[model samples]
Target: MPHPNPDAMAFLLSRRSRPAKTLRAPAPDRAALEPILTAAARSPDHGKLEPWRFIVLERGALHRLAGLVEERGPDLGQDADQIAKAASAYRDSPLAVVVVEIQKSSEKIPQIEMTYSAGAVCLALLNAALASGWGANWLSGWASHDRAFVEQGLGLSADERVAGIIHIGTETSAPPERPRPDLDTITEWVTE
Candidate 1:
């Protein structure tokens, strides 16, 4: 018989991500966040390449990024409203974890696989934070995708990209449940 973990199964079934903007102060400090990071690092990695890393953005780092958004927004062709929205995320966030996807050179393992692994890590980290009794949301905005923003602000390497930015903190209010996918419409069975 397969092992059963009813609580774990239930948690997975009911897991809901809190909105990033709704996350408040009192985020887990470094010592408290280490375990969550450790959990994220355990995600599956093809070829054992470990093609992902974490950058925990504390208050000061978040402020710096917020400032960068204002200073760099116009250069990137972002208008005032866009800049404000982008900057607010960093400016108001209690804490965030930047998941950096590292592209490793491997013959058998494709680069796409590495990118997938990084994405998996992002989900794992988000789940970990949620499971640890913190509100968490995974996000990637226009600024995150901007090469200059990522390179100059976060100092990502040439071969690296932002897979996700997981904002975690106290929940100001429980988010109302939204519509979920209809599995019947999305799933297809295959047999040979």
Candidate 2:
């Protein structure tokens, strides 16, 4: 027999990502966010490599990142619209957590697994924030992927990469539920 947590299941099923632009101030403070970060840290990490780290960006940092996006966007071949969108995301965000994936040299654990673990941490952070009554959205764009921007904006070393940038704050409006993938269409049953 297996025990089922209906409340958790229901929450999971109904979980929705809040738009970063629609999120406002009054974001979670350090105390409020500590537990959320803790929850996110509990995500699965194969071989216990712990290859991910979090950088909590305050409003000032967000604004700085927005400027960096503007500076580096044109060089990266991002058009004006793309630059504006990405810059506005940082400029408008109340707070954010940059999930930095640090690749570690391991004899047994492969690098891809570490990358997957970092990705898991990003989702976990987003979900934890949402579950804790905060609007959260995970974003990655040209700025996040650009080497120069990342190194300058985040001080990421060569071994580090941005897994995701998770914006968290108060919700300004309730977005309509978008259509979800049909599980039957995406899932395949396997048996041996």
Candidate 3:
């Protein structure tokens, strides 16, 4: 007999990311978010490098980041719509956690593995936020990719990069569920 966590399995089966546009205010405060961060830190890291970090952006920081997005857009050759969309993500976010991928020097662990660890941390953070009863969405756009935007807005080091920015807040409306992928189309069976 095997002991399985039905509740955890149920949540994973039905989990859906709430769209950032539909999320409102009343995000988790520092005290409330501490456990979420702790949970995210538990993600697997090859070599135990812990090749990732968190940057919690509060309301004021989000506002400044929005302005920084606008300032960097033109210089980065972004169009008006692109700039607006990117800026709006920061402007409208009640709170966000930027998952910074740290490239650690490990002879045994390749850089790709470190990147994978960071990505896993991002998913863990999103799941933690959702399980805490907050609406959460993982997002990254042109602004997040632009070097100048990352350096100026996020103060990321040369070896660091944005893995994902997770927006957390109250849900203004419940979005309709979209169609999921067919397992047969994507799954593969190997007996070799």
- For each candidate in the order shown, give its overall lDDT on alpha carbons: 0.95, 0.95, 0.94
lDDT of 2 by residue, 113-139 (tens): 999999999999999999999999999
Candidate 1: segments with Cα more than 4 A from true spot: none
> What is the Cα-based lDDT of residue 44 in candidate 1?
92
Which pairs of residues have clashing backbones in candidate 1?
A: none
Using all chains and alpha carbons, the TM-scores for the candidates as numbered come to: 0.98, 0.97, 0.98
Q: What are the C-alpha RMSDs, in order, of all predicted structures?
A: 0.8, 0.9, 0.8
Candidate 1 C-alpha lDDT tens digits along 1-192: 899999889989999999989999999998889999999999999899999999999999999999999998899889999999989999989999999999998999999999999999999999999999999999998999989899999999899999999999999999999999999999999996
Q: Judging by lDDT against the true structure, name the best candidate.
A: 2
| Candidate 3 segments whose C-alpha is farther than 4 A from its true place | none
lDDT of 1 at 160: 92
Clashes of each: 0, 0, 0
Q: What is the full ranking by lDDT, best candidate first? A: 2, 1, 3
Write down the lDDT that model 2 would get: 0.95
RMSD of 3: 0.8
